[model samples]
Structure formats: structure tokens, C-alpha cells
Target chain A: LAKTTQPISMDSYEGQEVNITCSHNNIATNDYITWYQQFPSQGPRFIIQGYKTKVTNEVASLFIPADRKSSTLSLPRVSLSDTAVYYCLVVTNNQGGKLIFGQGTELSVKP
Target chain B: DTAVSQTPKYLVTQMGNDKSIKCEQNLGHDTMYWYKQDSKKFLKIMFSYNNKELIINETVPNRFSPKSPDKAHLNLHINSLELGDSAVYFCASSQGTVVTTIYFGEGSWLTVV
Candidate 1:
């Protein structure tokens, strides 16, 4: 499993775009980078995922460079409700593909 | 309807006692997982069952056992719980290994005093 590193915390005001980057230097070709958003007292929710290049969803967008060593999750038009911990995970294609969640970046969206 | 649900959203017990948390998924998925979130809010995978077969068992303590009678239900049993065992446990499900999305249950907050 590849360990991921992300910012400890970040603050952004409403209507602004926020980008959180994750670094996984040892990420493998078969590994897929996925991001999850978690709020207090609730389970984490899937935001977006990408194997390479870019992938966009109704919620967020994911961008992966050629090296695949890092990925950035871009959340547009942030709101106070978007305040949550964002986790960057590198998942392998194995039988028991476990998602290793890092400490996650605490994103504080202020109004 | 709730896709994934865990019973007794909150569980409070004393140390050395045995407790069980039940999880069920209505998504008709074949895989289920148990994750523990520590005080620091770090999520760690504990056990995963695919098609009722034990697939992933992390280095979790033996005292923490997960049983899946079928594809839709997975239960976690903790024997001799300790103070450190107090944390929120989450149950999640996915279609298969390659699928990127994993739906998670609200969570079960376990407090061991």
C-alpha cells in the first residue's frame, strides 16, 4: 500500500475554489487515486477518483500528472457545508483491496 | 432508504465486556468492510468480507472479530474491549475490488469506559 501525504489543514471562504493535493511517491501503475470527504460524526463519502489524467464528477474534480506520483482534488464554489476532512487514498487492484486513509486535510470553509 | 445501516448508532459499555455491532447493506453489494476511526480521526481498515469469504484481515487485535453470514450482513464482535477501543466504527460496501466507490454507513460510536 502506498502511503499518502496531504496538508494538515486549510481554510477557504465561501464561493472560492479550494484545491487539496496529495503526494504518493511510490504509487503503482495499477493504483487508483480516490478522494473521500468526511464530516463530524458521519462516515466518509466518495468525492472523486482517477487513475490518470483527469476525472470530474458532480461533486469534485481529480487531476493526476504523468508521473502519477501525486493527485489534486479540486472543489469549486466551496460553501460552509463543504467543511470537512478530505482523505486521499491510493488503492491497489488486489483481492482485498484495502483503502488506506491518511490523516486527511481538514478543510474549513468559511462564509 | 439508507443504503448501509448499523444498529445501535451509539454503544456505551464497560471495559472487559464483550459487544457486538451489526451492519447491513441494502445496496445488494457483494463486499463489506469494517473500519475503525481513532480519536485522531484516522480511518483504518480492520476486516473485509467478499461474498461471505474472509478477504482482508488487517493487523487488528484478535479480540476484534468480524463475521459475515451473507453478502449483505457483516457484524463485528469485540471481546474484552479496552479503553483504547473507544472510537467510531464505520461499515462500508462496494461492488467489487476495482470499483472506486465505497458507500459508508453513518457510523457506530463505541465508548468503552
Candidate 2:
């Protein structure tokens, strides 16, 4: 299992872009970095995933550098509703899809 | 149509009681998992099953037992629940064991009084 480290909390205003970064120094070769967002009273939903370089989706974009030791989740033009806990996970294929979630970054998008 | 679903969205039980939360996924996924989110909102993986076989079992208490009767269903049973057991439990499934996208069901909130 790969452990991740992220900020405890962040504050942003509407219309601003928010970028949360996670560090997984001991990431394995077969590990992929995935991000999930969780709102109050709801389950976590996938945001974006990437192995190297960058991957973009309708909701967010993931940026992984050449080192692959860390990844960043970028939310463009944030809104108050974007306030949620964002988790960065490093999952291995041999783990049977088991996700180890750390203390996610609590993103607060203020009006 | 709710690809993944769990029964008893909310459960309230007294300490020392036993309860179970049932989950089923219609996405034809071969792997299922149980994750617990504590009050402070720290999420942790408790158990995982793939093709009706136990694959990952974290250091969760023995009182918390997960049963997979088939590929589509995975149920969690907690015996002698404690106050600390109060948290939201989530059921999730992925297509296979190759680190594909995982879908999550609307969580099951368990409150132990």
C-alpha cells in the first residue's frame, strides 16, 4: 500500500481555480494516482486519475510529473458547491482494487 | 438505475447489539469493498472481496465480519458494536482487479448508541 500526504484544509473563493496536491513518495511501479471528492453525507466520487503526465475530465484535471512521486488535482473555476473533501489515493493493481484513503484535504469554496 | 446499491441507508443500534448492512452491485464488477468514514471524516478500507474470494482484510476488528455470498453481493456484519463504531459505511465496486474506476453506492450511516 502507498501512503499519501495532503494539506489538511484549503480556502478558495468562487470563480477561482483550486489546486490540491498530494505526495506519495514511496509509490510503486504499478501504482496509479486517483483522486476522489466527497461531499457531506455522501460517498466519495471519482474526480480524475493518472499514471504520468496529465489527464483531464469534465470535472477536474490531474497532473502527474515525471517523478510520479506526487500528483495535483486542479478544479477550474471553482464554486461554493465545489467545497468538499478531496482524497488522493495510490492504488496498486494487485491489491484487488483496495483504496487506502488518508486524511483528505478539506476544500472550502466560499462565496 | 443505481449501479451499486446498499440497503438500510441508516441504522441505529444499541451497544452490544449485532447488525448487518447489505450491498449489491449490478455493474457486473468482480470486486467489492467496504470503507468506513469516521466522524472526523477519515475514510479507511475495512475489507475487500473479488469474485467471492476475500482479497484484502485490513486490521479491522474481528467483530466486523464481511461476507460475500456471490459476486454481486457483499454484506458487512458487526457484532457487539461500540460507540466508536458510529460512522458512515460505504460500499464500492470496480470492474476487475486491475485498478480501474470504482463506483460507490450511497453510503449506509450507522449510529451505535
**Best prediction by TM-score:** 1
Worst 10 residues of 1 chain B by lDDT: B94-103
Poorly placed runs, candidate 2 (over 4 Å):
none
Worst 10-residue lDDT window, candidate 2 chain A:
A92-101
Model 2, A10-67: lDDT tens per residue?
9999999999999999999989999999998788998888999999999999999999
Q: Write the per-residue lDDT of candidate 1 for residues B1-113, one digit (tens) a residue.
A: 99999987999999999999999999999999999999999998899889999888889999999999999999999999999999999999999766668899999999999
Find the 10 residues in a row with the least total lDDT in model 1 chain A: A91-100
Output the number of the DockQ-best candidate.
2
Candidate 2, residue B84: Cα displacement in angstroms equals 2.1
**For model 1, what is the error of residue B27's alpha carbon versus the real structure, in angstroms, after optimal superposition?**
0.6
Off by over 4 Å in 1: none
User: On a 0 to 1 DockQ scale, where is model 1?
Assistant: 0.67
List each candidate's DockQ score. 0.67, 0.69
lDDT of 1: 0.92
